[model samples]
Target: MLASGLQQPAHGMEAEENPYLEIVKRNAFDLTNTPTNTQQKAPEPLKANDIKLTGIYLRNGVERAAIALIEKDKKNTKPTYLQLAVGEKQGTVEI
Candidate 1:
């Protein structure tokens, strides 16, 4: 029997005589020949704030120890300066 160009040979016929085999073969060929969809491009990076900064301080003297405690209380949230000079103005130190 033949329907829609597909052949179904009699039960005793050889496999090479079946028309359905041709249809299946053609479908397999088309499936392998078809192309896949293209991939999408990646988006560009925007200029945004993504950087972070952290600070840590250690001191041994009594005056430096007091400043370190104050820094701890503030959580060292912002950049700060500490001074230890008694007679002369010393340079600022970042913590």
Candidate 2:
């Protein structure tokens, strides 16, 4: 009779010793249905403190001001400017 080198493992012992067995169970999630947000909320309105007066200029009898709108959460970035005439109105502030 020929001698066999390998021995059969116990029924539940093979599953307990396997490392990749848990991978299948971990990835058993819903693949077809996914949750997502379709509606986006409106951005917050700028306040009075967020605006700054950078400079003022006078040319030919007309006066204008350079108004700077500071960006949120940025310190080193340049602010956006609006050139407005003496009596021009932007939002709630008058130049």
Most accurate candidate by TM-score? 2
lDDT measured at residue 24 in model 1 versus the true structure, 0 to 100 = 81
Residue 40 Cα positional deviation in candidate 1, in Å, after optimal superposition: 6.3
- Screening candidate 1 with a backbone cut-off below 3 angstroms (N, C-alpha, C), the clashing residue pairs are 7-19, 7-20
Residue-by-residue lDDT tens digits, candidate 1, 25-95: 77865676546867778998653322223333344632321122124345546534443433433333222
**Candidate 2, which segments miss by more than 4 Å at Cα?**
1-49, 73-78
lDDT of model 2 at position 59? 71
Against the hidden true structure, what lDDT does model 1 obtain? 0.45
Residue pairs with clashing backbones, model 2:
none
Question: Model 2 compared with the native: what TM-score?
Answer: 0.39
List CA RMSD, all candidates: 15.4, 11.3
